[model samples]
Target: MNYFELDTPALLIDKEIMMDNLHSMQNYANQYNVQLRPHTKTHKMPKLARLQEELGSAGITVAKVGEAEVMANNGLKNIFIANEIVGKSKVERIRKLAETIDISFGIDNTYQVNQIEEVFEGAEKRAQVLVEIEVGEQRSGIIEENDFRTLLEAVKACKNVEFIGVFSHDGHSYKAQNIDECKELYLESVNRTLHFAKLAEEMGLKPKVVSIGSTPPFMLNFEIPNGVTEIRPGTYIFMDSSQANVIGTYDRCAATVLTTIISKPTKERVITDVGAKGITAQTRSIGHTATKGLGRIKEFDDVHIHGVFDEHAIIYNESFSNQVTIGDKVRIIPNHICPVCNLYEKAYLISEGEVVEEIAVDCRAKLQ
Candidate 1:
């Protein structure tokens, strides 16, 4: 079926563009001699995650245990939950998932280590975990060397836990002013993460995986150092408006919200069927990742969504209003593809204007 015939506010993935994105990231990882563990959080689709593995991805990364369960149920063996997991219930869920797959999660403190040790006790396999170093995002991670040492000491006491490696996210790299700044921040984060990895080594713990992530650095093709074993970029799999701005083009963006014009209220005001409920009200307001307005109207030149109601996107442009009538379908390049993906139940895969397949957003509401 032709994609144009689809209903309004439908999520669309250009199959060609999406495949190119997956291959490009895989190629970059290959060239740098690092394993590509593309984060499935961007698409939240088991089908896309499996495709990444088929295209030479070493494994898949997720933001939650529920997402990991969804992926594992669909046959993804190796999974990493890239967030500091807390709670006995969550740990139990991970333990059950561990029974079937090579699963792991992040830890920034000894308290988590103790919890993991308690949960995985007497189980057949040890709980695999990675220490998260706070590299500049100012988010959840161990910041001090002494604290990291203490955490490692706690891990040493855990008979059921295995310290596999350390990981860091250079999320602040998204705020880089230009290419030079982006590269500088990216390298600094990598170096800081490596510093902690080295500390773990000095204490007799050998880290098998030194993972670093953030889409800007990889999108700009920054060099990965020798010690870094893996890259866990999530947004690269489904490039959006903000990521496109980082590289100065939308040619790499594969996802869009397909909406139809529902009204022409005024000569300069047009309304789309989708609003914040569909494309979302997300925007990249600073640095190289900054994008214009709520979302970009792909069919118009420099025209953005002026505002959005709960169920309508407003476009206030005389030229845009004059160019189209009601019932005209258009595409919107969302600012943050992660949450935008979660807003939909299914995404239509299109190639050359034809709907090739319908992919379910398997982990759409798996937020726990």
Candidate 2:
């Protein structure tokens, strides 16, 4: 089927560009001598994760235990939940998942470690776990090395818990003013994570994995530091508008939202069949006015989505008004591809303007 005939507001993946993204990141990892574990939370499709594995990704990283279950059931063995998993039911589920496949998750506190120990005690396989260090993301991770050691001691006390390693995310890199700042954060984040790894080794604990993640730092044409064992980047697979701003190109944006212009209320005002529910309301803070919008319009550099309703994306551009008309099909490159991916159930794979395949968002809505 022709891509133009697909239903409006559908997710689209350019086969050529997607393949290029997959291979580019994989090759980058090879050059840097670090394991590439592309986060599956961006695309949430088992098929894409498999492609990453085929391209030499050591494993796949997910955001939730439920998402891990989806990938594990689909034959993805080496999995890392890059987030903390708590609760009795959830811990038991993680134990059950460990019974079959190699899985690990992140923890920053000792309470969470206690829960993990209780669930995995006397189990056949200990629950492999990683310590999440807060390297300026100000998110969910251990900020102090002393506190990290306390948590490490707790993990050691638990016979069922195994101290796999430490990981950190340079999410603050997204707000970097320029490549120089991004590089600074990249090195700082990795060095901070490596510090913890060295601390573990000094304390007689073998830190098997030292992971650092963030698309901007890894894709800003910079080199990964030595001793950084793994890198988990998700948005590189589907280059979003925000990533484009950091990486200095949109030609690599493989995923787009295919929507049709459904309304022309005024000469300067038009609406597409996609909205916050489709392309997401998220925008990037890249210190640029053009990128401060919701998403980008393909082939129309001046056209930008200014507003969005539940099912409509509003656009206001004089050039776009003069060129586009109602009923015309358009494509949108979203600002944040991760959440935008979870908004759709399936994506149409297009090669040379033809719909070649349809892949399910197998891990969609796995919020638990």
Candidate 3:
């Protein structure tokens, strides 16, 4: 059956293109001798996470404890929640997960260390954790050397918590002016993360995994420094409009929103069935990853969604409106694939225009 026959506003993944993306990133990791622990927050589907593990991802990286549990329940044992695990309830959940699988989380302060120490009081194994270094992203990471040492000291003094290694997210690379600036910023961020790893070594806590990632830096194929042990690129599996801008091509973009043209409101105005609730209203607004409009019209060249309402995507392309009728379907390559994925309940896996599988968004609302 034709994909246009499926309900309006469905997510679709091109199987061949998606597989190529998965293999390409894994090959990059293998070439650099680093583990590709892909961030599963991209798709949030256990099936895709398992496929990544089979395709050579060392483990899986998730954003929340709920996602970790979903992946772990699906038999993805080696898991890393790449965000600070706060509160007694979340800490206790980690304690429960630790009992059966190899699980670890991010920490930037001793307060988190102390909390984990209390939660894993009589657990079978010590709570494993990694300290996050603020490597220019200006996010939730320890920026100062003294702060890094202080957090490590707390981990060292802890009776149950075990410091695994240092990690950092160079998200700033997404806004780099060009590929050259992207490479320069990437190296600096890697060096800063490596510096923290060295500090961990000096403090007698030999880090087992020194991880650093953000898709933009890796997409450029900039050389991964020696000290880094793993790369956790999330959106590489399903290239989006923003990432395609960094590379100057959408050939690798496998995910798209399959929507039907609901109405031709005016001579130059077209509306699709999907909107802010579907493709989202996010724009890169900066450097190499900067995108045009809300979403790129996948079937038409130089066409984009002018805007989106709660349930309608506004299009101002007279040429595009002339090309399709009111019921004709079109695909929109989103600016950011991560959040766009969370909105759909399932994705139609297409192979040469035929729906082969229905991949559920298993962790759709696993925000906790």
Model 2 alpha-carbon drift over 4 Å, by segment:
286-290
Clashes of 2: 0
lDDT of 1 at 347: 97
Q: lDDT of each model, Cα atoms only?
A: 0.93, 0.89, 0.93
lDDT string, candidate 3, 117-234, tens digits: 9989988999999998888888899988999988888888888999999899999999999999998988999999898899889989888999998998788888998988999999
- Write candidate 2's Cα lDDT for 169-260 as tens digits: 98888888888878888888888888889999988897889998988876765887777899999999888888888767889999999999
Off by over 4 Å in 1: none
Candidate 3, residue 283: lDDT: 90
Clashing pairs in 3: none
TM-scores for all predictions: 0.99, 0.98, 0.99
Residue 114, model 2: Cα distance from true site in angstroms: 0.8
Give the C-alpha miss distance for residue 150 in model 3, angstroms.
0.9
Displacement of the residue 367 alpha carbon in candidate 3, Å: 0.5
